[model samples]
Target chain A: MPGDVNLWPKLTGGEVIDLLASLHGRLDRARKAELLERFDLDPTKRTRTCSKGNRHKVALVAALAGDVELLVLDEPTSGLDPLMELTFQQCITEAASGIANLVVTPPTLEELFVHHYDGAPARAGAASTSGGAR
Target chain B: MTTLTRSRESGPHAAPSSSTALTGTRRLLRFGLRRDRVRIPAWALSIGGLIAYFGAAIPAVYPDAAAMQTRAEIVRDPSGAFMTGPGYGLDDYTPGVMIANEVLGMIAVAVALMSILLVVRHTRAEEEAGRVDLVRAGAVGRRAPLTAALVLLLVANLAIAAVLLAAVLLAALLVNDLALPDSAAIAAGAAVVGLVLGSLAAVTAQLSEHARTASGTAGGLLGLAYVLRGVGDAAQPGGSTLSWMSPIGWAQQTRAFVDLRWWPLLVGVGVAALLLTASFGLVGHRDVGAGLLPARRGRPAASRDCSAPRV
Candidate 1:
């Protein structure tokens, strides 16, 4: 989900949601309706006539309605009101609770240091040495 | 509402399995068309209306041979040649010839503009607005958007052609009898011009991340072509090298009612095909929401007037 969701201005909020969900290979109508109600978005209204917060809600409903394994939201609440923000928090928390087998694997120290360090020392004339080292 | 979970033929991440660049093109086409329902009709009708009006009105304005000859003389002047075409069929000056020579250029310009706007609106404009990022996040393929845009261009241009053909046929029956092949050529010429420019706009869309820049580049090219056509026709009898250089000129050289040539239109088709190939190749080289052309970098530091307390 993008921070500022840009949609087809000519399409109603409902149509946009359906279009996105359909593209993702599914359309859970019940889930979509619930999300629309929770977000308080009028699905009949075209996106061009929507306010910034309303547009964000339209994207929110579409993303939430999808049955994806991961939901990556960037600044999801930037445009929402306080009440809507609370609703968003509740929804995300509830959804996260549904993940039963979450796992984490740590990278090896050598691998981590080699790939993650951005400020590593820049050594000169190491091009020929790297082949020998490997 | 009843819950309906309709699974597509493939899974969510079906793009890899299919190994096709144009997956989800049909859906995108439907979506694009729905979005432009009002826009397509408006453009089609206006251009078609102009053709119909001119086709019918021109004959009425010059009903007889003498009147048409006089009108043809005026059209043969330097100003007319510059604004119109190579002054085809001026000796005979029939209604069909008048419309083809004088009105086709103006109609072609409108069609080209329509094509450019349609392609840009779906491709670059959507990408610039961040809408494309969201769309691509789905099961949609990389080339689906561009394909959809081009398809929409085809649909819109076809609509114009249908209207144009009907108008020509109607005008022939009621106002002036025109050659069937000439009418068909006129319709074909206009639609082909639209396709040529639309494809050019598609290539331009890939060159820039900004919608305005992409549309502007395509429009600037169109303007240049129109100017070249004007200058080339004005200076020469059958059009000089400058006219041949433009897509607009290629369409005009069809000489629909006068000479009724079909070979000139092939130039537009070949150019459009080459441009389409280039644009599709460009898409794979760039990331979503990024352009082939590099964007200008901003200043590293703010000026003294941009202090935090200034707020």
Candidate 2:
């Protein structure tokens, strides 16, 4: 899974995006163009020349840009800035209709204090950040 | 409780693109071609270049019918048949036919090897690398990749055929003996042999999950074909009943310069079509990244090889 990010490093970003977008649904050409612009990734640049974050964008665009039934993400927002993370989160929310999103993340301090948990499925001790239960 | 959505062959996400199992074949083929820009060309050129070299060199070395006759006798032995072709037109004493007799068998094997490697590289190799999984998870259909790989190979083989035809014709003309029909038949033989091997490769790719295993399976069959055809041609001089069994043997039956038999080429096309249909069937039932033969589980812990070597 991790290794495929660098697959076909010579392919242009646009080509990679096109291939990935076709995997999920046949969104119109304009929608794909919008997605690429939103990510601020250069479509003509070879993948080998793209930055790490942009490479992530390529994979992220492939995954989230399509009309897929389920979006399963693990550490999807690790490298994005605060604004892009929110944009990423908003994209998921927009697809919330009949779509299942499984987002796996470590427990945060804000969640521990802001929310009340009375018999939550996960035991409280499993929330330790040093070694997350997940 | 609701489960995460899995898109079916027919689903809300389905469009004209993902409507069937082969919906994304063209896209996958394009993607495959982009990835293999250098690879396919190199293989095709090598085969074509060899054909050209043989076509040009044969006439230069054997200047007259008497020299050609001597060359024919030398290649009529069992070892000669095994190395070259069935020696069908070796006795004909013409440079055009002699080239076919001297070079076609080896050329057939070369093209077959080319097609086999190309198929396995695109199919099982992609699966082994885990790239196809990502492609599969998208709106792509199950059979698209296999179909695309075969299609790419078919195009490549045809291109090579055209190149060889041109090469042989030019060589025949340069030697002041223009045999267009003979050259065309030999070029067709090379092209169809590739198609046959490409089909066999598709079948082999489904037999094992690993690309190497798939390659080995297909390569073994190619070797067996070569041996059988060689033996058959040696045993039966004009054409052997034994050669009927091997794909290579059938190619020899094309009799490129001797008689230009088109029936064997048709049989090759038929066999290729049959194998391709079977591949589509086998692919539909197997899981992604797996072969028809189930993968065996490994030991819970590493065995002797897993331990560190002694200091």
Candidate 3:
């Protein structure tokens, strides 16, 4: 990557991850491997061919790898699944514990205030007076 | 040493505040090259191959001085001159100059197109795709993408020049008195035109948010340059300064084998430098993915369109 600027239209998952690591300017080999393994990303697949979840992971890994003071993330986990979202949050938490200065937008109420798994809206006040309606 | 290790080992990553914005230019360039691996080779091979063919074919067509004179006369007619621009070295009727006369104009246009496409693809296209901001988020300078694009273009042009030289030289039997100097000049003229148009696109890339519009704008300028020079070459009594008005005109004045004048090349190089500098300034001051000329809002109310089906 000493020369070409990859908009990375065709770069594979591994290549993209490596580029992210390089851009961060540290731990080239080890960090790329670790990020890919940690995210469960397939190294051989091109970014375009990746699923939305994989794409989100790519960005997440890239952000985590950058050697920057401030990271302004806007819905960084927009398209990810719950499991990957958890992993992303864990990674960010770990990454933030030491160096990065994060100015993150809090998670939307739709994600945090609503839990669809129980088939009920997670409202603190409505829980006790819940009524069955058609 | 202690601090370096601490920064490296202490966190996910570390940023030394003093590191320059252009820290990742080389990476961007290499990535760009990978993306263009196929397109660049295809363009270069076809153009180079055709130039080689022209170098061989033109001399064969005019084996004798008499034949060369007849061809020269044909090229002089205003209609005939329009396409090729007032045939330089027609009076001398030498094969080397004739090779140039027939090829340089078309080659100049091709070179210009190649440059325009490259700049737009690397700069505006990337911005349009929203990938530019992703790269910019890192240690890249505001001008690094543009710089990388131009630098890559230089390599592409050099490759073209090399391929052209090889092609011409291989066909170099001095058949119609084709000489090394003439062939090299033809290649140089083509190469110089490429640099001119490359810089033109660099400037244009900053003018439009949409890649299509940027490409169109650059293409339009190339068309204008060609027309201005073509008309000037044909209409002027004898090599008018009208040709001086456009970049292509400056290139043609190199006169390849006939005069081998190198001074006109300065015009193109100087203009290209100025344009490149302006582009860097424009990019540095403006927001990514937004052009200097902001897009205008459409009509607030929509007109009924009963005639067309909506998608």
The model with the greatest lDDT is 1
Which model scores highest in DockQ? 2
> What DockQ, on C-alphas, does every prediction get?
0.15, 0.19, 0.12
How far is B102's C-alpha from truth in model 1 (Å)?
0.5
Better of 1 and 3 by TM-score: 3
Selected candidate, larger TM-score, 1 vs 2? 1
**Predictions: Cα RMSD each:** 8.7, 6.3, 8.9
Q: Taking the tens digit of each residue's C-alpha lDDT, what string does model 3 give over B98-149?
A: 6667677787889889989998999999888877767776777777888889
Q: Could you tell which candidate, 1 or 3, scores higher by DockQ? A: 1
Residue B301 of candidate 2: its Cα lDDT?
81
Q: Can you tell me which runs of candidate 2 are displaced by over 4 Å?
A: A1-6, A26-45, A48-55, A67-70, A74-91, A94-134, B1-18, B297-311
Of the pair 1 and 3, which is ahead by lDDT? 1
lDDT of 2 by residue, A20-130 (tens): 877666554775677777767788898888776677677777776676665544345556666766666565555453453333331344433343322233343343233
Clashing pairs in 1: none
- lDDT of candidate 2 at residue B212, scale 0 to 100: 93
For model 1 the local lDDT of residue B12 reads: 39
Q: Across residues B1-311, which tens digit of lDDT does each residue of candidate 2 receive?
A: 11122222333543354278887788889877777778767876777777677667876787678988887887788777777777777757687777677677777888888889999988998888777866876757778899899999988888778877887787677676677877887788877888998899999899898999998989999899888887887886765877888887776787776778778888998999999999989988777877888667888986776686666
| lDDT over C-alpha atoms for residue B97 of model 1 | 78
